[model samples]
Target chain A: MSSSANEAAARASAVSEMGRTIPTDAEVPHPEGVRWGMVVDLDRCTGCQACVVACQAENNIALNEEQRVLERRAKTWIRIERYWEGEFPNAKARFIPVLCQHCGNAPCETVCPVWATYHNNEGLNVQVYNRCIGTRFCANGCPYSVRYFNFWNPEWPEPMNNQLNPDVTVRTKGIIEKCTFCVQRINRVQVTAKTEGREIRSGEVQPACAQSCPTSALVFCDINDPESAPAQLAEAEAGRSYTLLEHFGTDPGIIYLKKVDPHAEIHEDEHAHAGAHA
Target chain B: MQEPVVADTKTSNRELLDFVFAWPAWFFAVGGALNGLLVAAFVVVILMLMFGLQFLGYSHPVYWGFLIVNFVFWIGVSHAGIMVSAILRLTQAEWRRPVTRAAEVLTIFSLLTAVQFPLIHSGRPWRTMYWTFPYDWNRGAWPNPRSPLVWDPSAIFTYLTSTILFVYVALLPDLALARDRAPNPVSRAIYGVLAMGFRGTTRQWRIQTVAGLLLSAIILPIFVSVHSIVSWDFAVTSVPGWHNTIFAPYFVIGAVHSGVSAVVTVMIVMRYAFGLKRFITRDHIDSLARLLIVVATVWLFFFLLDFFFGLYGTEPAEVDTWQRRLVEPPWVVIAITFIICAYIIPVPMWMFRAIRRNFFWMFVTTILVNVGMWLERYMVVVPALERKSGLTFTYGDYAPSLSEFILVAASFALVILGFLTFSKLLPIMPAADIKEGQILADRIRVGRANVPAAMRE
Candidate 1:
């Protein structure tokens, strides 16, 4: 079908999603119960950093060199924070891939003076790069520490430049950047589905992190769609699933299934350990 | 008893105006040195903008560091002028005459210096105007009013305008005096324009006095609000050491504490610089010192109040932050310095009658107080930032780069350069106000106790 024909179908579906209210602007108002979310099964994650690499490659994020990491300036849209369970013979390593929570009551959203970052209709936290003046107030407001500021101009060597994704804009120096849940991929799928005259199916749009997860530990889906894989997993693991920093009332979009360790009693004294206990 | 403030009108005019008309060799040397440093700082800042803030040692978790500390420090320094001038003017303090102009000028210059930090701290300084200004463009955007950073530009701009007006209105009679006694027609013409047709008539004086009083009332609130808003820049953030209810009053009182101390320091500097010992007398310094003591005590109370609240608060983050500031390495030294310099050493030193009256002691204590205040701002900004939510594996650390040091040094030099330039162009001391104050003092001398008599309008 032609592009205009695709646009017409998309608008019709969008209007149908919004219960047949006349679409007011170019962008369609998101239907109710359309919160896009993730469910990370910690029991299955093997501490491998495949998701990190995949995210960097897909998003055109800057290389995280040793020096940058040492300076704490490494730009990782999604990263694995490892925690040691115990010492000596009983030592164990656990991994949690931390990313932007995209909270319903986001602290970062409210503090951005320029309105550079805000929650979109589809529960996506959107950041407008050009409008950001790099006050970094949002970074401070964020409990997850997922947001990263661009301290220096991003550069890519000649051959490396060829690997850059055309879909994603490589952000310049002196602005904040963070995980977008691969909004580009979401849009791509949306455009394709709209052109095909159908609703986005469950598990249709996967973020880089979810697609590259070797053990299927990370799952992304429309939580509002009860039949979606994430929704089914989240419901099945309801007893085990919990959000990060639930005390902050952030209402994070990501849910994590508790790591089932038989040796949980061994590390009870080490309260500093980043676990379900924390 | 009603002595003229300028002992000899001709000599005083020549002495004050000579600093402007004739540039002594030492004046050029000092000014040149300061300007040279400022030029280097300007270059460093520009390079940072072109390259990145990494050149200035900013990183994750500690995104706000040196520039923010300097911003708060300079803003605190500016608080003294309005506190001394506006409060004293409202209370009808007779001794406020010789000190008011210097205090008000310090406010103007320090504010000029302080306002630059927000721009410098901005990752994209070039785009700051777009964020700050209120013009409708294609973006259909305005700054989020909820953010204290947004409140900052409004408060700072209002304060700046009010201060400039306050200083100018108060300078009218002095400007007219300078015009009549100007060395040449060119100097006379310039002063004439500045004087704005003020012939020192009854109506002009009436308007000037009433206007100055009214401006003082207007400026006093902005003076209090500006620093409070600056404090809110931190308080509004969820950072543990910040996000306190006491920040507004705490910041206001701290500003006054440092500001009044700065006035004492400047008074001493002016006393020697222009040989104005007769006008800026021991009595004036003593009174200011007494005021300083009261300010210090109040500051000490707030300091403990902040600490007590931090300790009392159940939040683990707040407790951890207090520990970092009070118990951790390197931070303990800073905390100690802040206590000693801002309170411990100065409070007792300012209490002594001889110390307050003595120019050397007053200068030393005041400088020490300012040093402590600077450290206090550092303590407030860095310690809170150094340790955030604790979820991140690596704790952030910050040490200002060489460029940051150069920029800080240049900020001080710029303030001095501005003051020096101002001193030459205008009277640093308000001669007419002092004479009028003296005349008021001489009125109603009932018995040995010469009561401060009221002036007729």
Candidate 2:
């Protein structure tokens, strides 16, 4: 039997498990040739912090007030990770937009005692908050400081509450949280695509940070599609592509374009001048 | 042992004994209250500063100062308590029978005290759990687990659960003893609930003992890790003075020092208070105080080693950090005095039998040692932030706000209230463990006497 036949049988078992919800026309396309990926160009990143606000606004993140920041207890799902480079006179600082790498070999997924998080087929790491018992084992397990906890019951006084997303669940006081790849939006797009009977378009659902980048530094798309712009850009340059802490074997869905060095000194070879100098 | 008999007599002996022994409780209560008041007063002043009524508070050079100091200090205090309880059990120290309950209780209370420092250190206690899991269930809106702050709480919660279990499981047989041994029906009922229907069969004792030993094994590493991780909160950061290889062991040793000193302090009070001269003997104090001084030396040694190594590295950040640490005014002087008092001076005096044996000196020494340890934490926490980084860049200065102080006070109050409430429900000592110790002592005595003159011939 073909792999599709095997899938049909598996779906039949799943339907049995679910007690048959409606008539089972369970033939769904195997999201063929779609490996989700991101390309982040640091050279173009101005550290203007627009992506930070856009991500927060779209994600409905809490605004940790003065006191929270003062305590070093502020929570942010995504932020423009700022770091200094060089020293003194020639010192130039660099800013990178850091988020979940959505690693294929995600460290967070394996450590969740409750299976509160797992990697889906779409190369997106997902967190199921209601199922989370709030152990925070995943947080400790992750090298990247991307995972954040709901240390307290979030309060969005008055009108602030109105801005909350209806598609997402308002997490209670005790759970772990992190970048979900905008799972709510993905689910919406997925349902819409299914309703229209088509595969999800390559550039259809860009993550908020990627969409908000004015300089087009951040590009989120399917790397499996060779035609995708991010994949194209990645293939176009050797000076561009690298993953953070790649030696750790996390196979990050997020890719960073190395900061360009315009002033790299060129040295002349001795052989060229050997006619006289040698 | 029975209190109702006192109704016929001029006074009940147990009641009088309790009244006398309860003095430590009084002092701790009064002392905590006073400390609490001081914290509140400072907080109010800070609030005033925040409103611009005062000239200064926390500033850009050090965003977290005294509050961080207090947090670390209290966490240091918590360390020694659980360590004493777990180590005593691990070593099967029979003398631990009488004091284990008190120290374990101290662990829970001190941890409670320490956990609050961070919360109130924020000066906004209400939204503190915002670090845990916030209300936003969606991705990109959660707390960062990759942070030391996140790890600190997870580790702390682990410690809390294990410590609570440690104390509660140990309390079972004692609770049963209190239940059977209570003077009134009311006391019995309360003790009964706390005891969880413990009947001291050999099976029950075996199960409980094995469970406790396993927990201690698990808890000991966690206990080590909890403080190490707490130290990591500093060490992991890029701050110069805060990051050091010595911090892990040094903090551990300091925790043991403070914790052991606290145990001794409590024992001394209880010995006098409940007239428990037969229960907690001179040997216990002698061994513990001696052990603590040695522990303090180890702590000091680690500090020195770390300091010199940090200097040898000749890294600018480290050099600047140490310079600021050693040279800073008022705080530095106080800090030096604390280390000397806590570690160096205590060593020689503790070697003397009279000093270790004497209750007054022991109490004074323990208190001083703890104060010094607290200051040590203060040195670790505040000084690094006091100066600019190695790059000549400044962080921020912190003077704890009014809310911070009150909430800190409330935490101490909570500890006292939890301890007091717990003490009311159960005997702080394990009755079975004491019984077992008495049996072991009897067996040892018999074995010693059994080496007959005939056998020698």
Chain B, per-candidate TM-score:
0.94, 0.83
Q: What is the per-residue lDDT of model 2 for residues B1-457, given as tens digits with 9 covering 90 to 100? A: 1001102111222432253224455657655676666566566645533432222244333445555666676677777666777887788775666778778888888887777656544423344454554333332234455456667788888898998998888878767766766767986788788888888888988889899999888898888888888887767554567657778887887788888898888888767755567667677788788778678878878888878987998766567667766875656696688878787777788989989888888888898887787667767776676553422322334566555556555555666656655564456555566655544443223554742222211
| Interface DockQ of candidate 1 | 0.44
Model 2 alpha-carbon drift over 4 Å, by segment: A1-34, A46-53, A61-95, A105-118, A127-179, A195-197, A224-227, A245-250, A266-278, B1-256, B275-283, B297-345, B368-408, B418-457
Docking quality (DockQ) for each candidate: 0.44, 0.04
lDDT of 2: 0.67
Worst 10 residues of 2 chain A by lDDT: A269-278
Q: What share of the true interface contacts does each candidate keep?
A: 0.66, 0.00
Find the 10 residues in a row with the least total lDDT in model 2 chain B: B1-10
What are the per-residue Cα lDDT tens digits for candidate 1 across B341-382?
999998888777888889998899999999999899899888
lDDT scores of the candidates, listed in order: 0.83, 0.67
Global fold similarity of model 1 (TM-score): 0.92
True contacts kept of 1: 0.66
Weakest lDDT window of 10 consecutive positions for candidate 1 chain A: A20-29
